[model samples]
Target: MAASLIGRHFFIQSRNRRTLTLKSRLKYSSAVQAVSNEDVESLYPPVKPRFPPGNWTSMTEEEAWTRYEAMQEMTAVPTVKERLEKLTKKQMRAYRFPVNNKSVRVLEFQKNVTKSHLIKGLPTVYDSLQVDSLILEKIKPYIIEVLLLEKERLFRSRFRDIHRDSLILRNLIQTLLPLLYEHNTALRTSQVDEEVDIKGFWDRSGFKRVMWYDPEMERPKEFRIKYANDVRFQTAHVCDVSIRTENPLKEFLPIDDELCINEEFPVLEYHPKVFGTSKTDREKSQLTPGYNLGDPCEFGLVSFHNTVWLDYQRRKYGDAVTEEMRQGMGLTASFTWLLAQAYSQGFNSLLDVTYPMTTQTVLSDGQKMSFFAYQLNTIDMLKNNMANPRQNICWYTDETQLYEKIEDGKVIGFNDETCETLLKFLLMKPERRNINMKPTLPAESSDILSETEFISRNPLDLSTETN
Candidate 1:
């Protein structure tokens, strides 16, 4: 039994030894394993080179710099000093007022004259001046018949329906002017200037702004900008249509018209725009009345404003708003136009005009019409200049209905009074101003008007000879 046990032990020991040896052999084989042709081909593709360096240059510093200078000469690069000068000499900024804007409130407010916080009243002109008997009797009936005939023809036309107010106004002018022009010398000689650009800078107690980049200074506690975006600003108005006459209208009031020069009046503190935020502030400066002084038709006889632009106002606020909007339009259009004329004559916000200028204005929207007569008394409304006692004058009439509607070739509610008033406006003759009308232009006139020729000509003379 002992012998058998010893033999079994020896057999088990030998079996364990063989198992350990086999495990060691497998580990050694893995470490020294031979690579096959397939492994060699697939282990990894040969690594591709990237961003290879180019050959180094052997040029000296002087040679490199010379080459650079030559390239710069080819490109014509500016000098450092020239660049610095360009940076230092800042360009003048230009701000502009929109002629027609998206918002009625904005347009009305921007173009508002009465609410400008400027001087209000001047010597009032007699609006109820007697009309000539010839116009009242024979001319009135003829115009009425012509108007009726014209209305009938416009309504029956298939191509143009004449639904828009602008179209109606255009037609009215075309039909009426031709008839009146024959009888009226002023209307015949006076040419129409359409959409003439006028621009200038004047302070009607307008709010001031510090240049955005300017440093704060000791200012009045009340020195606040009218708008957040209100910067150095100016006025630029486009005269839609102006009747340019050969001679200026006679001054409505005598220069020595009695006035308590120190009479005080309340001023309107009104904001020009309702918009809360804006960034544009730079303003463009212009001083032209649509015509140079030497222009034969330099005098403005009448101004026509298209109230059809107020179509949006009527739709939003109802027809009642038309009167209020037009009243402001009449004031604004007349005021700006006269200012432009004054500016062109070398009068500015600082320098007042030597004589007053009278202009007639007609506002229409095809069916409705209103009339105004403006006499520009002063443009010097600056705070310091307000002591000058003269105030501007305006005479205006309410909107008159031309016709209600057209039905089946018969005109509905055709008004004769409106037609007569229109004829009166067209037939209104302009008399030459007996006074030295414009500022005393220098010998070398920017107006192209020779001082000698201007002074030598009689002030009452209607005939104007152009250079």
Candidate 2:
């Protein structure tokens, strides 16, 4: 074995030395030089392969079919098992089924299972799902119907409540109809001669006369002629009737003597209901300056007949009483006669007197009397002469006065002074006297200034002296 090994080693070494010598010889040879350039070019030439030209241009149809079949056989083909495996993978991915255990796999499984179940079980589940959907749909409509019915019930309840309240209010107002009618009648009657349109006096309805005791005249007199519809119109259509006594002695004998007996006898005591307790004796004292006292003849025997003619002409002509009447009766007599005529014409209220009292009278028996006379020209004179001429005046005890306008038996004007005077008069000794006076000031006098002296003054300096 040793000898064989030695021989093999020698042979291996000899072969390697020979191979190296050959490679060296080849590296240095000219053949290698020629091959370096032309060998690579010859192996891969730029030109395409050339073939010999033939008379046949193309293969016949059967030959071509055989060639195509052989070429197809040469291409790769997948087996049925391989194709099945690929299709299975694609299906698994598409349906998102659990190939591996994960949340993604669970969600995929749930979606596929639910969808498949819904589609496959459609026939059995359809009726149950439809019932649930129908329940959901009907719920909203049913709730809305219930709400609407409840709202209607609430609205009807409220309407009935308001209707009941209105009926109650109407009944209450009806109960007050009589008192309102009577009060309104008295007001209209008192305002007859104030240039008020008597046609509209009673709210399109005629008046019902109310009778009351007249202590002054000692007779049962008609206090007011009231209209039925006056309450609705808020209007007064009262005519105060004063009965003229044929026997003055019968009415005045007892009362006059008692009142005249003592200066402090409290003239208001006789008619405690008509006049309240006296605040001061000054109201019952002898007449003050600018006031008339005593009987009618003490000043002058001025008959109503004489003054009636002057007033008639003055009212008709709207001018001064005639000179004949003035000379025969004098201004005082003419005015007195005019007052009597006005009083006889149902203007017996002191407020209805058109003229101021000029003189007072004293009788031999110590009885005191005062007279208010009217002249035809008195209203014109007041309109033309008074510094702040107004439609009417309400005289109070302290010479405080209310200027007002009388229209349709309504005082349409009012002012601070007039309102104050009215309030004072309402609070006077004879509280019943306030019943005859209107509580509200006339609307016309509301914004009127009692004097124009401020207007005539210098605006810049507001001084009394003129520039």
By lDDT, who's the top model here?
Answer: 1
Tens-digit lDDT string for candidate 2 (222-245) = 422322210101111111111111
> What is the lDDT of every predicted structure here?
0.56, 0.24
Q: What ranges in model 1 sit over 4 Å off?
A: 1-128, 132-171, 181-183, 198-200, 211-240, 255-263, 267-283, 319-321, 443-467
lDDT at 4, model 2: 57
What TM-score would every model get versus the actual structure? 0.60, 0.12
Tens digit per residue, CA lDDT, model 1, 1-467 = 54456457768988999999998888777567675675455567776433223211333344335444433442242332222233224433433344333344442354333223222322243345445656556554444454455555655433323243434454456556666666777888878766667654454444444443312423323432222222223455665567788888777666556531323434434544443223343323444577655667777887776765666667777766554666666776777777777765555554567787878888775567888777777775543224455666666787788778767755678687776676666666788766555434443333345223644654576877999
What TM-score does candidate 2 reach? 0.12
**Model 2 poorest 10 in a row by lDDT:** 360-369
